[model samples]
Target chain A: MSDEAIKKENLSEEVNIREAGGGGWLYSDVVKDHFFNPRNFMRYGEEEKFEFNAMGRVGSPACGDEMVLWLKIEPETEKIKECRWRTFGCGSAIASTSVLSEMITEKDGMKIEDALKIKPQDIIARLGGLPDRKIHCSVLGDKALQAAINDYFRKTGKHERVLTAGAKVIDSVLNITDKDIEEAVLEGAKTIEDLQKKLKIGALGKDSLPAAEELLKFYLEKYFKS
Target chain B: MLPKPKKIREIYFDHAATAYTDERVVKAMLPYYSKTYGNPSSLHRAGREANAAVNDSRRKIAQILHALPENIIFVGGGTASDNLAIYGMARAHEQRGKHIITIPIEHHAILHPLEDLEKQGWKITKVKVNEEGFVSPEEIYKSIRPDTVLISVMYTNNEIGVIEPIADIGRVILKYRKEHNTPYPYFHTDACQAAGYLSLDVEKLHVDFLTLNGSKIYGPKGIGALYIRRGIKIKPMILGGGQERNLNAGTENVPGIVGLAKALEIAQNEKEKENKKMRKLSLYLWKKIQEKIQNIKLNGPEIGDDRLSSNLNITFMDIEGESLLLYLDEYGIMCSTGSACTSESLEPSHVLRALGMPYEYAHGSLRFSLGRRNTKQDVDYLMKYLPVIVEQLREMSPVRMEKQKHARYK
Candidate 1:
């Protein structure tokens, strides 16, 4: 149709623009799939896998939006391998979960602490930007992801493992030489709680724990260096 | 995708947040986006032509409200109009009295400024709403004193769909001022959520300031007008090329303004019919949700004509609002919790809490606000999915199921 004809038609009706997809802040396909057919919507584990459940089980019935995240983790890597969520939310949410699932799949073995850094904006950016109001749906994704991670660590006896990762711990409580700590880690001093107990207390000052340099270096690499 | 169960249209129940641009509003706004495109501020014929369109829209908006064209200051949307009203009042009337009184139920546009005003040393008093979500006239009267410069009570509660009596409350302030005969308490009502549900006239309502939003009335967003009664001295919130009487300074959103005016016209024109249709739907949805789903409570108003036509805020016990929403999303039913602004908060709704709703039940509330575009079929579809979805989600919730089991046994 010519411009004049389009103008005439628009004048006769409403100003409906048929723009090609991939224009907004969110990927239309990702949003569509998530909204239309949300994946991992329900938890499929036995009672043992769940660490803790803080369902958003109360509040406004008007939205009819609910999110449930059932989580499981690898004890060795402290990585989140499985997450099942049910969102009574909008398309943006469905897309957010899909994107979140993709991220989880890619980082299958990356530590949970690293996964915690993923924000709603990252999910939206994966698609594009979302409509302004739909930003909350993205935030819900972020919340579900965190809830699952928190659930995983809390369920098993590895709640203390969060500090063992790329974390900055000023160690004066327990002291070990860098080489000894490295040797122990290689020899499977796995959880830092075990490492602390194994190394024993009073062997070092708070700032004198094995290679404070490395902890600071890791922190710098992840955040401060940028 | 489950063998593609055919294509389905999403249910839109978040109209209180915004309405999809009505087809009529779109038709009205089309000229500015194309052939009739001209800067209203220009000196040339094109500019003059644009200026006429702007004036025409302004006049149409004025006609709907029975206000003078000069009173309608069109800006981006509800938020902008609100800021213009509250900020303009605070700055312009700084010397008059440094205090302002508004209700707890006011939108953030009003609440945020009142907060800002507090930082600026203005004593801001938030009037409390009762368990029924009604802000009393007595509270307004008690809050207003010698220093209370401006009194802003909304014409309606946005979240819970409670309509406030502006005339009754505004009269109290007027009576209070008759004795003092000096300090005129500027009254502003953010009627964005109530545009389609109520008849807004600055004169008959006797409000000093009133806000109209396009999106709420099915006009395009990013455009609305604030009616500041003549001789109401308020400073400009947005400063630019002296557009909007040098009060709001940005070059106007012409298409938005046009669209808004037409939307308002259509809303006013069709208010009675829309109200009847929506009241029936709201009442029906409310009844159906309760009959079909167990442990549901109607939060704002008992099912009646009193509630906002499109608002259906239902509270389901032991149900998480967001989870139910997700379950319903599978069936393509789109809705919102009360106030899209703070959906991610872990706390209960401020509006519902103020309404004396218990935190447990308040947190479980879901606002299924309806719109002009929604129909009986949509409600029927919602009715079909709601009970099943709620039951499914609740069963998945071990605690909820256990609680129900405990209750049933008891």
Candidate 2:
């Protein structure tokens, strides 16, 4: 928020702009464009060869907003590849993933470690800047990358498991439970919109992994065991 | 590079959180900050003079509330006042009963402490509010129990502009005592939001223990008065210099106390005129925004509502309040989303949520509170700048850009 945007021209007519989302000098044409209509966001189906897979998953059962990020890296070389992400966040979080994917795609064979070092400000800087309050949003982006990297190692078995199985990360990422959603939905929900609207998405199933319904059913049946 | 006008270009509308220190209050505190910089407890002449200043301020505040000078205690701020009232009274009177009743909409100043008490083995019954965020006296009456030792409610809501019926609710508690054999509930109110707008006669409101903060009422911060109503006995919350008749302890804030008194005097003096003016301005802004902006929802009561006159909460659909706040800040237009505490959370507002404001509207709501300093011109300028920013941001918004465009064309 620039100090200048809120000039009170007069009392009888203070411009009551809808208090909206994250912004700053980081809010430039690039950020706006990404936020307005993010490019390269949709997945191209399983046919697109994925080289690098980074998914940051964060959730909190209490606060009630769980966010997950899935990034598909199309590696042109041993280190470099293309990246695309699907995220569940406000416009900034989605725009962040799209912008981050775009930024990582620019460099070829880039080490994943360096890609991880990419600050949220660097991403916001790409746009123009984010507001002071929204700067926290930038941190959430970095967190998503960290979580995705951990997930990458988990799938590849390249590093020791950073997260305990089924344990929740407090702030960095939310652990979405297929079981929780299924039960909440099965309790009364009739449609996808009804399910999503009634409950927060704790987790989404990976395209390569078992379906969400299957995983939830498995958990439900296990819990229902005599 | 331009010379200043006869008046500044400052347009202040964020009075709900706190008001800028008034010039008169500043003048009243100058001597205490510099010349009279002596601890009220010291034996020296400077100290005694400082002590005199503290007593004078305390006396003035007590006069305003129609309380005895000895009964008033100067505390840190409203939060401490509320905590002391609820926790202090409950702790001493635990033998009286273990049950307590309070509304859900109280500023955490009172609610949080009660919540803490529940953890410490007290039976707590929380009353609910209606869609307007107003807690009903009927609900309070129904929720009261045999063991209930205290009943706490806020005089005015902090986030939304709903005014609680303190008098009516007080009557209910009074009725409960007359009908049943329950000792009267030590009625407490966090009046942090109502000091400048409503008429606060403790006798009429019938609050046993009331909390008020000077900072929120256009005086200095860290200074507020807690009215303990002559005979209400409670254990002290703070312990030190044993100041404030041992009800509160610490060296008296001589300067802050003086400023608080002067500020309260001015606020009480100007309440009617200022309230009337703010009533007109809030109506003006609310009407104009409804007409000019499309898909916008008003969060609190209508303009003619008996609630706080300075408050105007509006929801711009398909937008997030945080982003809109940033854009408004860019234009030097300051406002708030929810309470100051909710700024960090992605959740919109507890008050709005309690009022049944949906996610779509709550997420995009903005709080534009008016004050004595604001004039019609300031609001008019806001009307001019606000639409452009909304149009621009809405154009860039993924959720509502298309819809906003359609509405704009229509």
Candidate 3:
């Protein structure tokens, strides 16, 4: 190779994790550390070891990633005693969940309410920020945690404590609602592209198209007379 | 301190992405960069020397392809060659026709240009590939319209390594040309991935245009070649000092051309030996992978078919491809995933989708393109860790069919 080409080949091999975002930022040291050695991740055959009370799942294989979070709460203090997760996703997703698990369990434990306050941005901030395209990977774990929290509240007969406050933020990003999908399907926006053109589903929230399509399928089954 | 972790060997299995520049090719290119560096357009002795090197390299490449040296036009890379071939031919012959035909599985280099032409009042016919990743000649023949001016197909797919029936398709185009007594529709093949192993005789393939890049065949990057049949008309895309017979306008990349020629010479000379080695390694890896992993689907043409000798693409059910890629990268085994997450837009590979692969399986696909440098030990090393990684990722996957149960970490 030319000297320059050899130099480039060496440089490429040494490069740390890079943001999938086009900006070409290198992933943070913390992110790399967690990605290279994720913590509190459940492994094969270890599924029954934790004996967790509630679990939350988010994302989907069709969407290219998914995360499952298992939480154990202390009844008296209502503090999260343990948090374990398994995410089938890119490095950002795995690292975000690993960091989030450590953050929630540190200094005794985060209270259930406080844990619910954790946002996708908080996980990203702890990891020194993820690529723009990968921020949604981080969101999966938090959403799964929220679902698990809701599951916990519903099982404990504390329905009033179930927090569904972040629905609006997600809806705006997705740029479509259940009613919009129902209306579009009813109006014969049958294909994904037709629905996309009608609703502009992927204009901002590129990662949200799959979820919208899944929701559209449900709505179609419910409302489509045929 | 904890015992130092055992150092993992880095094994690259993504040659289809790009090959490592061979040292011999580099050595051949080094002197031209500085010692003999001069603009080929200059009238000085240094310029003559550089010009001579360029001519020699062109002659060498032409010799291998069984084409006249004058027909070779050197450009920047494979994309440039494709753009020049498609856009140049389409615009130059616009008066005669404004229609193009290509397969759905063509590289973006060909497809994007066709789409651009569509905006300029060109009709495009995208033929579909079969499940085995074969584009039928009959399908192309059926799609041919009187106004169709160009047909571009890739010699082999970069992702799945399935070889297209370029020769058969060429015969189809030739038949039309003879019957209609007009050269309205010209055949173009992006032979970028086929240069290392496949036959490149333009007459045998019956192609009016062919594209080959330096980067994919262990040569330096930033250089490519287009073979335009002697009588074919093409318009220049970039306007500047006339170069490459006024088709491509740029000062010759002398060193890059030298490297490309050297790379191609070595590859063609050792093609049979290297092909045998890669085929054996690829089959071994595929067999081992099948024996180890469950619910895995091999993508592309089956072994012993007319597939690239160095590629093995597989999809693991219930596991995300990118996750598995990361895990493998952790162990210093480099490969690629067809998952949408790796792409800008979160959609699976269009080639896989064209082959009628489901979205879920396409999202879980991985490509392992072996090279001559790879050994059985490298495949063994990959096999050792791959099954474990797949099993673990499956357990973590939401779409995994296994029953859900409580899992705890200590």
**Could you say which candidate leads in TM-score?**
3
Candidate 2's C-alpha runs over 4 A off are A1-98, A101-226, B1-10, B339-342, B400-410
Clashes of 1: 41
Across A1-226, the per-residue lDDT of candidate 1 in tens digits comes to 2323432332222221223153421235456555445555554354456453322221122232345565556667766666555543334544576667667656454466777777544666665445433443233555556556655555555587432343323442221234334433332344444344333222223345435445334433443234
Docking class of 2: incorrect
DockQ for every prediction shown: 0.07, 0.06, 0.37
DockQ versus reference, model 2 = 0.06
* TM-score (0 to 1) of chain B for each candidate: 0.93, 0.92, 0.96
Residues A165-208, candidate 2: write the lDDT tens digits: 45332212233345334433333334443333333332232331
Error in Å for residue A158 of model 1 = 16
| TM-score of each predicted structure versus truth | 0.68, 0.71, 0.85
True-structure RMSD, every candidate: 12.2, 12.2, 9.1
Q: Where does candidate 3 stray beyond 4 Å?
A: A1-26, A166-226, B1-5, B401-410
- Fnat across every predicted model, in order: 0.05, 0.00, 0.63
Candidate 2, residue B151: Cα displacement in angstroms equals 1.0
Models sorted by lDDT, best on top: 3, 2, 1
Scanning candidate 3 chain A in windows of ten residues, the lowest lDDT window is A6-15
Q: Candidate 1's residue-wise lDDT over B238-324, tens digit each?
A: 778999899888777888888888888888888899888888888788777767887766777665655687887876665566556
The sequence of per-residue lDDT tens digits that candidate 2 reaches over residues B171-227 is 988899889866567788888888878777788997888788988888999988788
Model 1 spans > 4 angstroms off: A1-226, B1-7, B339-348, B401-410
* TM-scores of chain A across candidates: 0.50, 0.51, 0.65
